[model samples]
Target: MTEETGRTVKPGRSDSRPHEDLKLQLPSERRIHTQQPMSVTAMSRRLPQLVRRAFALAWRVDRTSTVLLLLLQALSGGLGAVALIATTATIGLVATGRIADHFGQALPSLTVLGLATGLRALAGVAITGLSERLAPRIGREGELTLLEAATSAELAAYDTPGYNDKWDAADRGADVSKELIGDAQNLISSAVSLLAAASVLTVLHPLLLPFLVAASVPSGLAAVRSARVHYLGMLATLEDRRLLGLLRWFLVDKTTADQVRSDTVADFLIGRYRQAGARIDRTTDEAAWRSARITLTGALAGGLASLTVWAVLVWLLTSGRMGIAAAGTAVIGLRAAATGLQGIVGFGARLYRLGLYLDDWAEFVELAGGHRIDRGTVRPEGPEQVEVRDVSYTYPGADRPALDGVSLRLARGEIVALIGENGSGKTTLMKCLAALNLPHGGEVLWDGVPTRALDARAAWRRTAVVPQEFARWPLTARDNIQLGQSLRGGDEAVLRAAALCGADEVIGGLRSGLDTLLAREWWGGVELSSGQWQRIAVARALHREAGLLVLDEPTSDLDARVEHRIFHSLRAPARDRAIILVTHNLINAAVADRIVVMREGRIVQTGSYTQLTAEPGLFRELWLLQRDRGRLPVQRTTTDG
Candidate 1:
């Protein structure tokens, strides 16, 4: 069924459009909807577990600092209680009519108060120092853990939207590890203070304790409500935020600057940016208004509760049930109790909100770790014959398969060329052969054993690929080539590889030769032309010196002379290693021992270039088209015999 976004909806109704805000909600929305505005009882039940988890994580980061921070916060709260008691004692002593006699008694209370204040200040400093020491370590540990998971995950996981969403959410939550520690500490501090205040109120009178609790409830509820609104709003707008970020990058990034100007797309992109911004603003404003309403209502209710508490205190005083000194202490206790209660409630709400993101991080970590690609125990030295047996593979969410019933065999010391139109399954077949991707149906075999049954890492170690879209690494020319064989250091082999690909000529022309950095943004660094970069990429692939080499459109950016030279160089290496070359240029394919032509995810013809061109087929038609366009030159070959 088609949705309002003009996308054909799947079984789960996943929306493909980036701009369709209401078309789909984040997966988290389902959980939120099931439990909207979580109750205080639920929060109370979960708080202990969350606090323990946070402490354990913090402890893992720095046990000494975590213990010290907790001790300091507890001490600070204890001092606050001591200071309150001392204040009450001083107030009682000052109530005495004989100032000279009572001065000595008041002096001890005053001294105790000063000591408590000083100790509390020291605790604050100690707590701050410990927190600063621990937070960064915790954040670093959390980020590293997530990064490890991301890098180690199965390559196919990256193709799914579910994985991407979870990854994005986890990336945002990485900092929450530090935040959770901070929140846990705040929760502990606030709870301790609240207990101290409650004890003071209880000492004043048992009735005052209930009155204080009643007065704090509404504000706590308000905090919970506000936190829920904010978090849910963020969940709803996550995709929009991502889109806005991408648009901003397109508008400002140096890599896209030329394209933006050449295509005159700045105004169109800006309009989209403004639209996304406006949508975000509307969502935030709606949340703010909802929160404001809840807050105002809570304030009104809390004010009434406070007035009732005061009225009760006044009645007690007027009826001679409470002494003036006790009444004054109770009034002071009430104010302190209210402040402590608010602190506890506010921190609790914040901790609960942050805990949700932490859960996402935890879930993503488990998912990444659990779904690892099975690198089997069997390890092979090298394959003499790599065979694809009825392989078929489809991308995630794709209706049609990228490769279907494709079978081929690659032998050592032979050059095989793959040629096809775009989306013709050539690259997919090559990826399967390289062990970068495993087929959904059937199997690829190394020698006589299936590749999946052999160790994937070991199998991949024997292969090297220069993809169509090769990475332009921001490093020195030497380092860029050396990265292909990182386990081995740069030496004569790297230089030889560079020379063989004609990249040495490009490097020789540079100011510092091989030492010259490829990034233009860095000091004393220079950029290379597209063709020059392509040569570097070719050099990098050649540096691997693997048993099998796959080159995909490797000469697309090179001049005719350089292209011919690279192809000629490959022929010498073909004596020992298997070579798979994919290209559109018919002349390049003509050099290969075998040429395979694919159409619509299946190989249609497999023969020598001359044999395929002699008959009327896709290859002949393509050759004739190239000849007519003056892209192909006539050359005599021994295949005519």
Candidate 2:
């Protein structure tokens, strides 16, 4: 049993909290194949692909920047090598004679050294500028690709196990895509420097280059291990971090702030936040300790190897196997090579970690996170009628179906009301009709063609929905109604729709009238009451000029007067379109030409309201219950009067 939700979580399923639970489980844990560190061979194979992917993205984003960055890195490395050789020549000139006598002879070497160093610095600056320019474009491209994949996927993808988790990982990958440019640049620079310096060392002596590589091996291993540890640890605790963020938002955001205080859940929520955070902290601390120990051991081994290399250099000089000038140059060459090796190891490790994330992004985009919409190419015109045929749907992680062999028919020029208790699949059936949820066992057809045969977006363009939780857009009152699309009649059409839903009265009172911003949080904005927002939501739906309209408890937040006005007016314009209304209010269902009563995912009753009231069934039972309750206020008022 957990202290947060007081629910008993099964063993081996520690992170299996329900989606509706305030305390979220780690979806990423279920998504990942393993938490183990990647093998060296695996990283070696993956790095080349990631590097190619990064450069490809950079080239596509800005070809000029990509070319300049490559040129600058190459130039910088070559200049550094030249500078080292020039320094050695100057040293030999000074060593072979008195400082005063060699001054004139050394001037040329000194000039070469100065010029090489100056040019390398300039190249470094140019590389930094180009990298900065390319990074943001790469990030933006990554984000656009992610959005395209996510938005194009089926709606059911969000309900599938590991799908949401994969999306979250991909989102993080997109955010860090900007770092790829820097990592790629560093890898290129390091490789060039290491190659150039090692060549110089080999010319000085055959044995010197091998010893330098030997010295760098241990540290390289350590850096890779540390990076792997950090990345795996982060992946393990991804959900806990998300949970903490959710709790903080609940505590601080204005929407939930009042509830948190009124319900006195601040202490409980804070406790959960701390507990989730502590879990992440423990994982992070363990990883840090392990990485530190590995790094320390590597450092000690590297130090010993470095000592051996220096001792060998000393012996070569003392025995006259190498000249003093060559030995001095060897020392500088070894240091430069070692620095390059260290940079290679460190940046390579970081790049490997980043590559893992980019892999997530790339994989998600390629496969559409396992939920790509693959419907047919048929483009739907305005649906004259929609029919459901033995449709059944079972949501992810559920045993029972939400809609079990449900069948219904809706035609133009009529209003169909779906009346049922909560969880009776009314909303599911409505979504099926809208082509939003493709059935698993049957089909929903528009104009006698299966919805799957119609292009999903084109089919949806003919739907106008005002759901129970309607959007309170933070835009001008006119835009709220128009929803970024202009009708043939333009402003006149918008006003007519608003007038139909009684929103014109609400708009008339705003400080800027139709131009007023609807969000109170912004400057020159005003907030509307719940009733007023419902009016706008209805108006927005009415303005769409769609053939099919679905209203799920549209009047739930409206006043009695507005609700009456909406219900009374629905049938007038519905003559030319099909309207589906889902409401618990029996009085509202009276306006529908047909009332479909659902129970336990099946249609139990179907008839006009007057016919259903005369028959004895769930509809009549609910009608009596509400009818008695409706008369109670009138009865009380009569007695009091």
Candidate number with greatest TM-score: 2
Residue-level lDDT of model 2, residues 32-118, one tens digit each, is 545645655666677778778889999989999998998899899899899889989999999998999999999999999999999
Number of the top-ranking candidate, with lDDT as the measure: 2
Worst 10 residues of 1 by lDDT: 17-26
Residues 1-641 of candidate 1 have per-residue lDDT tens digits of: 55565565556544663443422346655466436657688678778888998888888988888888887888888998898888788878888667687999899998998999899888988877777777788888889989987876777776765677777778877877887777778788878877887887788778888887989899889988888888888886787888887888989887799999999999999998888889999999999999999999989999999999999999888999887777877787778778778877888888888877777788778767345676676777667788999999999878899999999999999999998889999998898888888889989988878877888778877888899999888898988888745645456777788888899899889999888899997665899999999999999888875778899999999999999899989977787788999999998898899999999899899999889999888888888887795555567699967
Our tally of clashes for model 2 stands at 0
Q: Which regions of candidate 1 are displaced past 4 Å? A: 1-25, 28-37, 316-328, 369-380, 454-459, 484-489, 522-524, 630-641
In terms of lDDT, the poorest run of 10 residues in model 2 is 22-31
Error of 2 at 333 (Å): 1.4
Clashes of each: 0, 0
